[model samples]
Target: MLVWERPEPRNRPVPAPLSRDRIVRAAIRLADADGLDAVSLRKVATALDVRPMRLYGYIDSKEELLDLMVDAAYAEILPVGDDWREVLRSLAESVRHTAHEHEWLADLLGGRPQLGPHALASGERVMAALGELGVDAVMPVTAAVNAYVIGAVRREIAERRAERTTGMDEKRWQASLGPYLRRTIATGRFPALATVVRDAAHLDADDTFRIGLDFLLDGIGARVSK
Candidate 1:
């Protein structure tokens, strides 16, 4: 059963209550500090100063807790612009921004169907913003944008973790690869890619994300215009 479907404990609003909200908040903290892999039910219980078994009263399993965490993160994605293009652009960018703030979020984004209230409300807002479009175009077109956000967030987070693990920022890392890249390119096996590597703007992740999003938004506009 969905966590939201469960009845809240009578003590929910009481001080220091053991409730779903508290549990989710605690779990999100753990995830934020130590990535998703470090967050287990036992760890959350420890964070809350409660016994592991006691958490079962609030959440049935880790999966449920993850759903709650993702929904909680969705709270960070605010309402966007009135125009559908701006709506989708802001929506995508906000998700990317929030994921950066809470890196663990990338692990679950678009990986599951988020039915939690906050997630549903965000979806409703998007749909309302896109009401000018044909009903059929809304889902698929928006889905395309969502897919892009998911992939982009994952890639960004992966690069972040890589930088952390390797103790090198992207610039230095790429520079370190310079010799091998030069040697490989000299072989004339990837002329086009080598040219891009040498001449492309090599924009920061933020610009790259925005540029990719603009491409998607333009595509969406063209699709709707046709």
Candidate 2:
């Protein structure tokens, strides 16, 4: 007897050529265009002209994609010289610049342990620089530096986002609160805050970021020199 007709081929569409790099780049682009919230698998797949299921072939979950994205950002930060202070400053500035370019990056910093290859390499650079300084408890030193960078960048990003949302810069935002602030100051409940706010020269975003970074480095220097 003649062989039965071949069973109907499955109707599944051919998945588009996909790789982890492509998927992560698409996700990063989505996040860069619109904040991190916009980077879901479905949205990324649509952006890449593939089925959402296709992404699972390369990435296990959104969290893994995010980790890769953060690692990609870290990859941009090349290490500097062997001098501990200089190395740390360069690293911090590199991170700040990266955060500025990819606003979503600030959100991911310190959100989880960065165990990715690039992330680990960046961290190793920091530790190696600190190790040269003969710092006691290198882990704490690493934590402190990381905390400073994360906090500084988070504040910077938050302020920029606030300005975007309100259509106002910090000066204007503070002016908007002028009347209430004046009233509160007159009450003498927070004399020091009033004095500083009234008398202090308002630092621009870049200046504020640099000054804070220097202050953090100063603290670390003090510990190292002791």
Candidate 3:
């Protein structure tokens, strides 16, 4: 009897090759490239060279994928340390950077009180920093910090949306504003507004962010302290 050599077993296929982490990362990259509206299970699966059903093995739906993506993005926010003031300052700046880098992130983080795990973890870090400042009640400090971050992010998003809709570059905007603004300034009806406009020809986003951060921090330091 001729012994027939059995064919070598085909390498076991990687079952459910799509993973939660991989899916989230792909979705994030897709969002980064094409904006958040571009993120979908089908899009991610296509990007990963797999069927959309395969994504279900790891993520239940696009909503879950969004939650995961948000958590992953929030992870970039570094934890706070011993110095409460410094920690607050650093955290605020880090958030500003994150918001600017991921313009869609602010819209993803809406007014919902229930935060994703990563966001909650960042909140805890902020709370821990507040604790170091001897804050007895958790609510007030948490409320303050949350309000500050949300407000700043909202403002940034609004400005970005305005820029997108207007289609005018900053230089064009300034040049157009020059003549009209001068006329507006000459009229005494808007004295306060004119003064601010004259003082700052063009409002810079970074300067606005810094000013808002400082104002919020000052308020928190003065009011939250024992």
Stretches of candidate 3 off by over 4 Å are 1-12, 113-117, 133-136, 161-167, 200-203
Cα lDDT tens digits for candidate 2, 1-226: 1011123223345556677778889999999999999999999999999889877766678888898899999999866975877887888889999999999999888887877789889988888877866767578877777788889899889989998998999679778999998999999999999889889998887788788878888887887777
Q: Identify the leading candidate in terms of TM-score.
A: 1
Candidate 3 displacement at residue 141 in angstroms: 2.1
Where is model 1 more than 4 Å wrong at Cα? 12-16
Cα deviation of 54, candidate 2, in Å: 1.5
lDDT (Cα, 0-100) at 150 in candidate 3:
68
- lDDT for model 3 comes to 0.73
For residues 1-226, write the lDDT of model 1, one tens digit per residue. 5788988656645334598888999988988999888889999989988788888988889999999999999999976896898889889989988999999999898777899999999998999988898898989988999999999999989988998998999779878998898999999999999889889898888899899989988888898898
lDDT of 3 by residue, 1-226 (tens): 1011122223336653645668888998898877889998899999999888777656666776777777788888876666677778777777767877777778776544446667778878777877765656456766666578768887877767787889876787889888988887798889899878768655477787777778877877877564
TM-score of each: 0.94, 0.87, 0.82
The stretch of ten residues in a row with the least summed lDDT in candidate 3 is: 1-10
